[model samples]
Target chain A: MRFTIQRDQLMNSVQDVMKAISSRTTIPILTGMKVEATEYGVKLTGSDSDVTIESFIPVEEDGIVLVENIEPGSIVLQAKYFPDIVKKLPQQTVEIEVDDHFNVNIRSGSAEFHLNGQDAEEYPHLPQIQTNQSFEVPIDLLKDLIRQTVFAVSTSETRPILTGVNMKVESDDLYFIATDSHRLASRKIPMGGNVQPLSFENVVIPGKSLTELNKILDDSQETIEISVTENQILFRTKHLYFLSRLLDGNYPETSRLIPDEVKTTVYIDTKELLQSIDRASLLAKENRNSVVKLTTKENNRVEITSNSPEVGNVVEEVTAESLEGEDLKISFSAKYMMDALKVVDCEKVNIQFTGAMRPFLIRPNENDQILQLILPVRTY
Target chain B: MRFTIQRDQLMNSVQDVMKAISSRTTIPILTGMKVEATEYGVKLTGSDSDVTIESFIPVEEDGIVLVENIEPGSIVLQAKYFPDIVKKLPQQTVEIEVDDHFNVNIRSGSAEFHLNGQDAEEYPHLPQIQTNQSFEVPIDLLKDLIRQTVFAVSTSETRPILTGVNMKVESDDLYFIATDSHRLASRKIPMGGNVQPLSFENVVIPGKSLTELNKILDDSQETIEISVTENQILFRTKHLYFLSRLLDGNYPETSRLIPDEVKTTVYIDTKELLQSIDRASLLAKENRNSVVKLTTKENNRVEITSNSPEVGNVVEEVTAESLEGEDLKISFSAKYMMDALKVVDCEKVNIQFTGAMRPFLIRPNENDQILQLILPVRTY
Candidate 1:
């Protein structure tokens, strides 16, 4: 492969693909990034058998020449050093060429690097999904959807299926749901009339894949096309393609886990409650579960408190905008509540409590599309 | 003890003293910060036996009231949680009161914290250095002196004496020197004639202590008083007192390590040489010492190169402003060269090389206050 390309553009593409490459991969060739130069542009691919990322740079874009002197060829270079080398190249323009002996030469300004490259033929072929059905979602909205539900996924591998986020399309609304048996987060959005009326169930993408995808996808109004096959899913933009293998198994039904009856309801400023919980967690963190208690008081006031026997205790009172039904006191993981509150993205939040020992719900006061449920700890 | 203090000011004091407190200390009382409130001000002290730092917040300073409603008493609070608690307090003003049962109560706005406190009488008394002889140096200059030499100290405790920076006064000039036996760094500054003429020969301060002090001391033109006793050195400012114990051993003489004769001389842009060495080290880092070779070529051009047999090789040519004497090729640790070059504080640096095997000198092209020496590694 021989090509002269813009250094910044190449660096960005290398970084994007690097997210998919893991040094711990059992397959040796999968640890390397495949670089290909063709008449159209240069493409870089990285994969660890679980997720594969490919980024392409065109020779010319918007009447500006981004690449020149392209020769059609392919080689795989060590993913360990290629990204750092490209990032620290001296000049704005970089030239990369491969010799017959599989020696890769990278030159920029007065600096030159010669790296041992492996034949690209050794790289495993990327899974190609031959599917006609695809859905489009705006990049920013997709990122938001991932952020809102991904954190609630089970980090423990005891239940492997729970480690992925379940994506389902029912009626005209698409739902993303994640639960770790302790907390549940779900977000829903209309698929819009432009998208084809398609339905998919049991399509679970690993939470880690969505997290990495969220990091690489820039927030833009442009729509990205997503296609799903039996075992793999692909997210594609104009010059980028991200593929992640679907987890094999059935995701548990989480709809029943969310409580329907509310014995107490409270409306409070989201920021105020978040800060209070954070302060309480400072002491609570010394304990195993980092549990903090919130008790509704008279005159629309709520008190948050946590105590660590060996360290100390803290209590903070926050005034609620309004309160109804039976007064309640409940204890739950402060981290879970903080995580749920941070993604609310609104000033006021409505919290519904079934009882002191049951799961509760927190959601935006005005929006019903996003719902967060946390199982309360039995402190009594 | 009871006092209402400004949260920001109190937080800063807590953070400064916390650096001296460590949980690994054998003395349990040392893990807590001693808080003493006198009629004049509130003082916070933390110590790890080797080093002690005390920060005072006066009731009034510069016509501003920093503390009010003070009652004379003292208590020791856990350093681990006190700092974080004060940092996240709800209000700008925090009121702290200690009861007879040694329970500490902290209140701010609607937040209240009850912490377990110990009697301050158990805290060790700070060393009383009764020395009449004291010297003063501008805080910024002291910080610079520490930065230039401390990095060269030996991190391995095999030779405990080499882990400290040696401070000496000779011929009306004060010098700071440190070396790990492979490389040496020395910085000198003149003691103004207005100050008393005094000298100390073996005052070696621990590198860790100096690093912590440097972080606590802000850059300012104001001079800070320094007093050295038989085993302790005290650095005092208007509201801060930093005390560090001297290392208990004879520091080996390092003057002979720097070559006095120069067989080759090269002057190069400091930034350019630093960057070239950094890039070459990328591949060299795979090896143990991260060694890179520098070879002088014709026309005042120098080549920096490194090769990892299994990975790759990189070569960068840097243009030097001038070259004189014999042509030379020398191999040295890129990390040491980078560390030495970063502190030069000059646009161009003059390097003096005796030969391929001997040590070399790097210093500012025109100034003489600072000098750095690095021993070359044998590659061939």
Candidate 2:
């Protein structure tokens, strides 16, 4: 392969593909990135068994020539140092050439690098997801959906299916749900005539895959097409392609985990409650899980307290906007509460409690699109 | 002890003293910070046996009341959570009260923290360090001197004394030198009229202590007094006091390591040389020390190259402004060269080489206050 491309454009594409490459891959060839140059443009592919990423740099963009002097060929170069070499190249334009024996030569200005390249034929082919079960969504909205529910997934491998986020579509509504047996987070949005009526019961995606995809995606209003098949899913944009494997088992039913009857409800400023819990958890961190207790008081006030036998205790009083129903007391992990509060970008939030041991519900006072639930700890 | 202090003022003083407290200290009391409230101000002290730092917040500064309602007493609180607590206090002013039994209550706004405090008498006493040999130097200049030479200190414990920087004072000049048997860095400055004509030859300060001290001192024009004794050294500012123990042993003779004879000299832009070597070392990093080779060519050009048998090689040619005397080729650690180049903040640098096997010298073309020496490696 022989081609010359702009340094900045090549750097960006290399970085995007590198997100899918893992250094711990057992297969030697999978540790390298495949580069192909054709009449259309240059494409780079990286995969780590579970996820594959491909990025393309066109020959010309917006009437500006980005690549020139192309010779159609393919080669795989070690992904370890390829990105660093491309980023630190000493010129505005870089020329890459591969000989028949797969010896890659990269030249820019007064610097030249010769890297050993592996045979591109040894690379495993990316699974093709050829299905009409696809939908279009704005990139920004997709990123938001991933952030709102992915963190609630189980990090342990005890239940492998619980490590992924479950996506369910019915009629014109789409929902994403994730639960780790202790807490659950669910978000729903309307399809708005863009997608046909479709239903998928068990479409579980690994939480790690979504986290990496979210990081690679830019916050733009541009739309991306997501296509789903039996065992794989593909997210395709203008010049990028992301493919991830689906979990093998069905996700657990999480609807029953959220409590229905609310014995007490309290409305408070989100920022004030977050700060109070943060301070109360300082002494609690001496223990393993860092748990804090919340008790409703008279005159629309709540007390947050945490105690450790070795290191004393802390108490914080936060004034609530309003309170109704029966007074309640609950104790839960401070980390879980803080994680739920961080995603609720609203001035006020309402928390409803059913009992001391049941999972409580927390949602924005003004919106019902997102709901977060946390199971309380038994301190008595 | 009882007092109310400005939150911002207390936070700054706590952070400064916490730098001297180490979490892994063997002594139990050393894990706590000693806080004393006097008629004049409030003082915070933290020590880890090797080094001690104290910060004082005066009752008033520049017409602003930093502290008030002070009842004279002292107590020691666990240093692990003190800084975080002070930073996250919920009010403009914080009140701290310690009962006679050493139970501390810290209140701010609607939040209160009750911490288990130890008696101040149990804390170790800081060394007095009474000596007539004292000198004053500008804080900015002292910080600069530490930065230029500290990185060259030997990290291995084979020669315990080599882990420290040797400081020697003679007549009106002070010199600092450090080496790890391979590379050496030295910086010198003239003591102004504020210091008497006193000389100390055995004052060796640990490199780690100097690094921490440099980070705590701000870049200001005000001078700080440094006093030296048989076993300890004290650095006293207007509102802070830092004490560190001196390393005991004779320092190696480093003057002879820098060769006086020069067979070849080259002048080049510091930035260009640094970037070229950085790129050349990418492949060399596979090995431990990351060594790169430099060879002088015709037409005032230098070639930087590194080769690995498994992974190919890289070569970069940098043009020098002037090359004189004999031609030369030398190999050295890229990290050592980069460390020296980073500290020499000059447009141009001059490198003098005696031979391929002997040591070489590098210094800024504009001044001679700092000098760096590196020993070349044998390629054959």
Candidate 3:
């Protein structure tokens, strides 16, 4: 492969692909990043069995040349060193050439690097999702969907299926839901009439893949196409492609986990409640779950408290905008609550409690699309 | 103890003293920070036995009131939680009160924290360095001296004395030197007859102490007083006191390690040489010591190269301003060279080599106050 590319454009593509490359891959060749120069542009690919990322730079875009002197060929360079070398190259543009023996030469300014590269033919091929069913979602909204639900996925391997986010399309609405048994997060976005007539159920994408994809996707209004097959899902943008393997087995039905009845409901400023819980958590950190208790009082007043016998106790009172139903005291993981509150993206939140021992729900007061449920700890 | 102090001022003092407190200290009380309130201000102290730092906040500085409602008393609070509490408090000012039993209450805005506190009497007293001789140095210059020499200190404890920077005052010049056997760095400052007539020949301050002290001291032209005794050294500024137990041993003589005669010399741009070495080190990282070879060529050209048989090789050519004497090739640790060059605050640097086997010297081309020496590795 022979090509001269802009340093920054290549660096960005390398970083995006690097997110999918793992040094612990059992397949040694998979640890390398494949670089291909075509007549149109340069393409970089990285994979580690579970996830694969590909980024392409065009020869010219908007009349500005990003890559030049392209020769159609391919080589796989060690991902371990290629990224750093490209990042620290001495000029705005770098020239890369590969020999018949797969020897890679990278030159920029007066610095030149000769690296032993693996034959691109030895690398595994990317899975081709040959399906006509695909949907489109704006990049920013897609990133938000991932962020809102991915953190709730199970980090433990006891239940491997719970490690993925359940993505479903029904009734012209797309829903992303994730639950670790202890807490759950769900976000729904109206598909409107823009999405094609396609529906998928029980499509559980590994949460790690969604997290990495969220990091690589810029917050732009540009829409990205999503395609799914029997075992893989692909998120494709104009110059980038992210593919992740779906977890095996069925995802558990989580709709029943969210509480239906509310014995107490309080509307409070999101920032105020988040801050109060954070302070209470400071003293509660000694506990395994970092549990903190919230109690509703008279006159729309609520008190958050946490006690650690070895440390001390903290109490903070926050006034709610309104309160209804019975007064309640409940304890739950402070971290879960903080994470949910952070992604609420609204000024006020409504929290509903069924009882002290059951799961409760927190939702943005202005909308019904985002909901967070947390299983209360039996601290009494 | 009772006081209401400006949150920012109190936070800075807490952070400063926190540097000396370690959670793994053998003495349980040493993990707590001592807080003393007097009519003047509040004093915070933390110690890990070997090093102690005390920071004070006065009732008023300049025309602003920093502390108010002060009652004279003292208590010790867990360093683990106190700093974080002060950081996230909900108001501009924080009210702290301690009961006779050492129960502490902190209140800010509507947030209240009750923390268990230890009796201040159990905390060890600050060491008394009673000395009639003391000298003064500018805070910024002192910080620079520590930065320039501390990185060369031996991280290995095999030679305990080499883990400390050797400090000496002679002939109206203060010098700081450190070495890890393989490399040595020395910096000198002319006292200009303004310092007191006190000289110390064998004072060695622990490298860790200087590093922490450097972090705490702001870059300012204000002078700080330094006092040394048989076992301890004290650095006292207007509101901060840093006391460190001196390392107990004789520092190895390092003056002879620097070559007195030069076989070859090269003058190069400091930044250019540093960047070139950094690039070469990228490929050399697989080697234990990250060795890179440099060879001088005709027309003031120098080549840097590194190779890892299992990986690949890199070659970079950098042009020197001038070269003289014999043609030479030497290999040395790229990390050590980079560290030394970073401290040379000049555009051009003069490097002198004494044959291929002897230690070479690097100094700013314009000054003789700072010098760096590195022992080359034997590579045929």
Clashing pairs in 1: none
Question: Residue-wise lDDT of candidate 3 within A99-205, one digit each (tens)?
Answer: 99988899999999999999999999888888777989999999999999999999999999999999987677899999999999999999886554665665999
lDDT of 3 by residue, B1-380 (tens): 89999999999999999999999999999999999999999999999999999999999999899999998999999999999999999999899999998999999999999999999999987778888679889999999899999999999989999999999876778899999999999999999875546756669999999999999999999999999888899999999999999999888877777778999999999999999899998976666579999999999999999888878999999999999999999999999999999999999999999998999999999999999999999987
A1-380: candidate 2 lDDT, tens digit per residue: 89999999999999999999999999888889999999999999999989999999999999988889999999999999999999999899999999999999999999999999998988988787788778889999899899999999999999999899998775666788889988888887888766554435459999999998999999999998998888888899999999999999988878777777989999999999999999988986567569999999999999999988788899999999998888788899998998898887789999999988888999988888889999998887
- Candidate 1 has an lDDT of 0.92
Q: Write the per-residue lDDT of candidate 1 for residues A1-380, one digit (tens) a residue.
A: 79999999999999999999999999999999999999999999999899999999999989989999988899999998888899888899999999988999999999999999999999998878788668899999999999999999999999999999999876677899999999999999987664455445558999999999999999999999998888899999999999999999998888888887989999999999999898888875556569999999999999999988888899999999998989898999999999999999999999999999999999998899999999999876
Residue B9 alpha-carbon offset, candidate 1, angstroms: 0.5
Residue B245, model 2, lDDT: 94
True contacts kept of each: 0.81, 0.94, 0.94
TM values, all candidates: 0.99, 0.98, 0.99
lDDT, candidate 2, B239-281, per-residue tens? 9999999999899888889898999998999999999888988
**In model 3 chain A, which range of ten residues has the least summed lDDT?**
A193-202
Error of 3 at B69 (Å): 0.9
Model 3 spans > 4 angstroms off: none
Each model: TM-score of chain B? Answer: 0.98, 0.98, 0.99
Worst ten in a row by lDDT for model 3 chain B: B193-202
Query: lDDT score, residue A119, model 2?
Result: 89
